[model samples]
Target: MADSTGTQARDTRLYFPHLQTLDETVRFHAERQPQTAAVRCEGRSLSYAQLHQESNRIAHALRAAGLKPGARVAYLGKESEHYYEILFGCAKSETVLVPINWRLTAPEVSHILQDSGSELLFLEESFAPVLEQLGSAAPRTVVRLGATEAEPDSFPAWKATQPDTDPAVRVTPDTPLAQLYTSGTTGLPKGVVLAHRSCFAIRDALAGENLDWIDWREGDVALIGIPGFHVGGLWWATQNFNAGVTVVSMPAFAAGEAVRLIRELGITTACVVPAMLRLLLGEPGVTPEDFTTLRKIVYGGSPISESLLEESLAMFGCEFAQIYGLTETGNTAVCLPPADHVPGGPRMKAAGHPYPGIGAKVIDDKGQELPIGEVGEVCLRTPARMVEYWGLPDKTAETLVDGWIHTGDAGYIDADGYVFISDRIKDAIIVAGENVYPAEIENVLERHPGVAEAVIVGRPDERWGETVHAFVVAAPGDRPSPRDLHRFLAQRIASFKLPAKYEFIDHVPRNPSGKILRRELRDRFWGDSERKVN
Candidate 1:
């Protein structure tokens, strides 16, 4: 399909054939498309030249603040144009950017900062309370995005002191660019180190397939509602910025605000989780008219319910694509393209095909490849796969084997090469596209004084693809109210990780090896559902 500019959107390879690195992409646009809009948020916009200059200043500022190459710097804020500046700046300075989830509690935030060994921190003013709660535990050098008198060190003021000249630091495509944290089976978060190559590996792999749904075109206005902390949010913004398209960033997603932004900005394309789509549809004033300019809506992070997909296909009247990957896989290694989005069709149940350069295989318990239609561990080999789990060589060795990532997901590849995900080999629940590990929640619940045992599981929810459900055993004669547990967990973890539903049980089921029978607990909630996951 030709884009608004009458350019063949499918001919992307002809346009962006040599964007090898993030800094190179920025420089390419600044030199050739200086006047084009690069990013926009909350009514503010930055052109390519302006973005390049500001990031140059940020790179200098970070360097002056004692950050050297390979140093980690953390940012705790919602989506914004400033965040992209920091991202690019980090690339220019050869520093690694670590974005922490704003939804996490003070302790949770502190843990990531400490774990990453980040010396500098950038945050939004709204998170001052979390910093205050952290006290001396917070990072020593903090710069507030929109600082007030009370908050101090404003990001604008800091950038003004630095030179607006490029650092021109030497960095390779393999240089680590970002560290994204994901919950491990042990309940602690592990930092996934992404390299410059990780960001563009998938794009390079898709050079031949000029899928109009993903191709960038002049005059394309993209709406970004996802948080910048997750790969989905960070990569979406970078992808658009790299293409020199205008990106409208939503600080945080709200059903009403998202609808308003889509209408007001005339967003031509958007990438969202199924829950975001449902929320937009549920908004009272939203209609087909609101999304008229929206040409494509890409979703992933969790399987979309058939009902929601059908309703969305009818309501939005836009092309749909489903991306499948993990933070450790850069972003997308497999995609269910628009052509396969037929409702109720057999392909609808599949996760779509792997990208051209991605290799996917299902393996049995003995580590042998499984035949078609037999479910087993899903393994993926792609250039986009992460270099390693930061500072954990042992864990990295286990995950990355012979250049192939052993994705802890169970699925089967059909005769047509379509991949169908049956369940998670790892006990991770995806709530609105965010991965929530059961062990993380169980650790929090079992800590409560009135709780003797706890097991967390996922249950189907219409809005969020799946919400956390907890089955707990109270102490001898003590009853732990849901309200109390909620309050306790609120101070310990992110709100999204909290249980939406709770049940009191007399005993917690476990195998002889003392491993929690998550499948058994999940079965109680999932009933006879063929797929164990939502």
Candidate 2:
């Protein structure tokens, strides 16, 4: 372990090199909790022992499908027990697993599948339609979500009747675990290659730490109520499981259904996004008792309002820990401790000090460290940093400089070393607690026939913290209503990311460099405002 002073421990002979492979973690749990509940989905539970055996069989099937050690296999499905099995199975077999977002469109999903160089795709029944036209998309084998066919074909399921044995391939710590595609503010989405050790280290850091916010007890089941495609949802699930905790999961976030599951399963811990948190909090007849049974609730995405936080603290009768993290760090590098949730808390506005074993510093453009209370860019150096941006060497270099992943958040560190997020350096908006890049919105808006050029910005919102606003230049002859614009955007992009306000602009301010002066449009709304949306 490194010293707390951020120096290498040369004098100590106990050199704990981080575990580099995902199989190592799976093996550790398989032996420790063979019969313990490892995963739960839609009322079905799989014990750790059973999970290991199933993954072994899946690994064998993957090899039978002619997959090489370093082959990429995208798991295209919803939240389910089989999801993790496929992920860990790929890890055990030294294969890269890419779990596609169920929310993405057919074309969007195709781009990720093509970029990852996936040779096989394991999709659920619901997503079967999207894979219908993937002939030239790069996968030789397409595995269905259900039972296996007697004869292997282009699309088959080999997991049902396969035998369990040791995976033939061995992977090192640096082995790539996934190629998750996230939208870049500059242009198209890029694949972020995160290694097994990177994410596992994140979970490992949270280990044994007291979760005062949530009342986590032995044998108490938690809910994996989010999609598996995002880093947070997936890693948090593994985090609880690494410690032998039970987890009940759903396909996606839904209010009434999620409440039912929590109550019915007697779930103790739940990881939620701000939007869903609000939805659940707004559920009628929901009182302190409704969520009180839950020991703790962890929420992030957007900064929670004071009112929401207060209600959660009182209603849950436990701590409400708010986390601040990025996918570039493979899920989390910082978490607001439970103790910091109460009144007169230290670093109340800032996400609590960096998690144990992780170091964060605020630096200026020149990379010089800034003083506490000074706003600067937040940079992170930790075991959980992603390996690189796949197929984008230049972009990767610009992002990860000198072992520090540049988190493009404009924030400050307090005297107590607590980090406070002020604004995102990139023109990205957090709507309903989900990161929605302006570039993505612009791309979709520009596709409209009556739109010439579109620029998207964030507007201060009381309910959502920040809502997307679009300024567009009309084409030949047009007068688009706000409702028409919203409906058009709703058809192209996710409903939550559509522009809430539309402005007709004759010209967009651009500097000599031809870069759109987004700051100008942003200033129009937030100039007289007191604070930037966190």
Candidate 3:
């Protein structure tokens, strides 16, 4: 480990010489600690040796199946040991992995599959209907997971026949590893192309900074509750695995099951969004004892209420930290250290300071830097920054200016260097930690025959951080109730994206430019809530 002083560690690459690519790190650990447990999911465990061999097999199989380097392989399923195997296999063969959220509707799933140009798709049998609906839109090759298939085309049969020898493909740190799709401000989701360097750049910097809380130790056990599709889950699991630690992953976020797994696995550290913590607290059998083994808990991606934070602190009795970043930035660029997590510290509400080697600035509309304490767009420049939005040069150019990523979040830096997120400049609704765009839902709602027009906004909810609320303009001589619209949209979008409440208005609020006045609708619902975001 590096000393608290950052200089020596930075020069030495934090004693990790294999920082050239993720594949290098995996090989490094496989050689040194082959028998050590690398990952665990459900009742199965994979040692470092097993992980390396499985990934190698998968890579060879992918090559045999005619998947060339730089080809995109997508996965549509929940978290599992197979996730890491395929992810590392992609890195080994220089293929990009695209993990789609299983909650998406068929059209949404199809859009991502087609947009990413996925050559091969790995998914659970439960989601086979989604592909059946796609027909021509589906990927060329589909591998079914979960159950054993005896046919020659089955995932198990194919991987079992492949060679266990490493592919030994040449790749640089800049090689693309994954394409994570964040909901687009427009209707379609935009793929954020993340390179192999993203997994290590920030982590290596932190290692040099001697930030022990964020660092993984020899016997550390990490619990990943977040889905693998998002940067949070994949990044967290990779960080721990890179450190040669064990990662216990849950299939999906179920409050009761999460608590049980944490207790059963003796998870020392965890990464979760605030909503998960709140939900975990509500589970019937969850008690303080269940979290006794946890040493640290990192929460972010949405605003955490002080009341809930305090409740969690009292119940868990563990170190708490906050991470702030986006899918485009790999993961955390700004992190609130555990020291500033005091009960009523001024910095508690802040997003914390930027990590070492990370540059953050608040800029005005003209791209001019704003003064400290003045709200503006939060911009970040870091080595861990994404390569681009996959295949969207214009959108990539729009977000990445020079070397900085324009975070489209309204925030300001304090004199103490903490970033305070005030509002979102983009029209996005974060419902229970899931990014929901109004345009996407509006597009679905407007397609209904009885809906002449629609505008979607977020409203505060006690259970979910925020819930989608819709204001609809019914078609002449035909009116649709909220229940009717809900049923209509049931097959079109994720259930979570469905509006929690609806207001039938004659005319939807629009500016002279004919754009929906989302702020006006948001203000009507938010009222005097100090935090514009729920």
Candidate 4:
């Protein structure tokens, strides 16, 4: 594909030809390093050989349970070795894995399950209440993740009866492997359908480049600080697994636990958000000595504050690279290499240059490509881009136009190709790496009995990058307390999506045509800030 500059991007497949499909990763690595630990989580570990065998069993069990090729298998749980087993099993069975964010409310989870048309669901016992709340929306075949010996519907018990032989299912690089749901602008979540090839495209492009930026090495033990439900975490884990490195999974991210894991396991590389970095730095008794083994720390999700970046650089004393992209772009297509990470370098604030085979351009509203340093909507063309937004042809066409993923981010590329993000065009708030769309929250807020109209905007936050703030207009003679509104929103949405602050307004500002002036409202909170996003 040619970039906006009319230059053709190199084909990634030609650079590295191995591991064309997700299933091929484990099989190839198992043959080469069968005894090496593929993943470790909560005192449990799985070797390459063991993971391959377990996934095979899961594949056979899925088939025996009447799941057909191309079926959607939903997983509602935290990060774990069993989660990856289900992931690869879905790959081997030609079924798509839909990993639900465990943080989502029952209503939100139900929407994904029903929308994906999943026939089976693998859930953690802790989320039993959520599944029960799903009721009719829940899939018919539900299997518990860690079940006892007496439980016949447990994942371990169910797969144990199946043979641990490869299902030998036919799959192509374009086959849909995972469906991750991202918050939509229309008060719902849209499933982003990613294919097997998405996992290998970026890695293939960088294979023999010998670039130290985000490179993998022998005996490298990586910390999966992010959860598997997010594309960043999933992509990072798969990249390490493909390179035959051991990945230590954190079932849930905790600053104290992460520090312990890094020091105890001699973790060499990690990928995390800036919020996590702050938490680690603030953790009690944390010091520079605890991160001696860390060679590189890759961070993204939101741009890092200069002060925070400098502090993290000093604490870790390791190579730091910033990644920029979305789930639609298969995690990361642009990388700010360590070379440009100077404390106050000119490019320090920039997002970064696109990967070898990836193309990025900023375009005006008229669809014309903007010149260097001209602020506009950023677009990316990469082999790692999602196949489509699942079952939404109209949205797919709108987002994936002419082979370029229209990233709803307002940014520009400098003469040196360093992308600088200035604002978000879609009015989406990212709280601690989690995307929270205003429309989704506003829809819920306005549902409250006292709220006549509501608007949600992001306020720059020191730790979370951004926090949800609500501007609510109450009904006539109805006085709504912040506490009451918080309680109402808490039960309906994820905790992260709840508004951190609420202000009662007489009226919500709107344009002549009735469109809410979101930017006008947001500008009040971001006054004089260099960038609109924190």
lDDT against true structure, model 3: 0.86
Clashing residue pairs in candidate 1 are none
Pairs that collide in candidate 4 are: none
Q: Indicate the worst ten consecutive residues by lDDT in candidate 2.
A: 7-16
lDDT of 2 at 160: 60
lDDT per residue (tens digit) for residues 58-175 in model 2: 8888887788887889988788888888888888887888888777767677788888888888877677767775557737777777644653542334676678766766687688
Misplaced by over 4 Å in model 1 are 1-14, 148-152
Runs in model 3 with CA error above 4 Å?
Answer: 1-17
lDDT tens readout by residue for model 4, 1-534 = 434322223432112245688788888778877999999898788999999999999999999999999899999999999999999999999999999999999999999999999999999999998988988998989999878857898877888789988888789889999999999889899999999888888877776464556777767899988888899998998888777789999989999999989999899999999999999999998899999999899898877888999999999999999999999999999999999999988988888998887899999999999999899999999998999898899999999999999989999999988889999889889999999999999898888889999999999999899999999999888978999999999999999999999998888888999988888899998998878988
Among these predictions, the greatest lDDT belongs to 4
The lDDT for every candidate, in the order shown, is 0.85, 0.75, 0.86, 0.89
Model 2, clash count?
Answer: 6
TM-score of each: 0.96, 0.89, 0.96, 0.96
Q: Return the TM-score for candidate 4, rounded to 2 decimals.
A: 0.96
Clashes of 3: 0
- Cα deviation of 468 in candidate 3 (Å)? 0.3
lDDT of 3 at 191: 94
Candidate 2 overall lDDT versus native: 0.75
- Descending-lDDT candidate ranking: 4, 3, 1, 2
Identify the runs in model 2 with alpha carbons over 4 angstroms from their true place: 1-21, 133-135, 146-157, 203-217, 344-346, 479-492, 512-514, 527-530
Worst 10 residues of 3 by lDDT: 5-14
